[model samples]
Target: MFGTKVIETFKEEHTGDVLDMMRDFEVKKRAISEEKEGNIVLRIPAAFAETYKSLNSNPISKHIFKGRFTETTKLKRDKLNINVGVSKQFIARSVSNNIEHAKRILAENECSNISTILLVGGFAESEIVQERIREAFPNKRVIIPSESGCPQRSSSSWS
Candidate 1:
């Protein structure tokens, strides 16, 4: 029943809820491909009903636009409407914060003249992150070994 018209109409009218925002972030973390862009749609499985229902008191979370969301059918694939706006600035700012923290530590220790940087975590494996680090510390050497895989793997690999 989730035809093109239904989906489009829902997107146009939905302001989005906290659950939608969280869902989008979760999907982005799993998706490392830089090729994916533009609006992202996520299907809220019926299994997550218990968790979503608990957000009634959240001021930031809005109610799903009533009939916009279809009920739980026998197929278990319910159509729900939720929009989450995410900007690249969010990611850039997060990484920038860490970089700033590193700068602070170096300044405090009077070791501001750092040269080499070894990125070993999975986040370090991110192309955007690697590029950012390179740009931020252009003069310094940034080396990320091939062993750095996903974050979980990267952590264990370093260990």
Candidate 2:
């Protein structure tokens, strides 16, 4: 329950259908550029007040409070590959904050760990948001998939 009642309720729905539809429109509109050059789709957890509260209680919070936020990037290539990066700050704090941290983490690890980064969830739509992520990890590919209901999309974009 961060923004309003509507948003809180929406976030409660684990499926993230509405968010996906909006992102799908963005992909079709090209409002957000796609670097993977394929039909991409992404799904990320919607940040709700409750989710944050839960995160705060997790062991990861220890790292986050220390300005080291770890995010697991899963790229579905011929096989399932997962890479983890530690950011200078917590990504779930705010939209800009999340993107900036994601960028830093990706930049530090993309070359050695991952080939591409998939931006999804609600915060992924911000242009300034994704830009920071892209600028930091220019060598690694970035893809925001066309989502039309439920943030889940194919993992092929990473390959």
**Candidate 1, 1-159: lDDT as tens digits:** 333443444444453643574556555543443554544345554334333433334221233333523332222234332222233445567779978887777677567767788887656756667878788887889999874653444566776
Query: Candidate 2 lDDT, tens digit per residue, 36-144?
Result: 2332334323343245445455321222221221234232321212121111122223546665666576568544577888887555654545677778667878887
Query: lDDT winner among the candidates?
Result: 1
Q: Least lDDT summed over 10 consecutive residues: which range in candidate 2?
A: 79-88
Residue 51, candidate 2: alpha-carbon lDDT: 51
Model 2 segments more than 4 A misplaced: 1-96, 103-111, 152-159
Model 2 residue 31 CA deviation in Å: 9.1
TM-score of each: 0.51, 0.31
Native-referenced Cα lDDT, model 1: 0.53
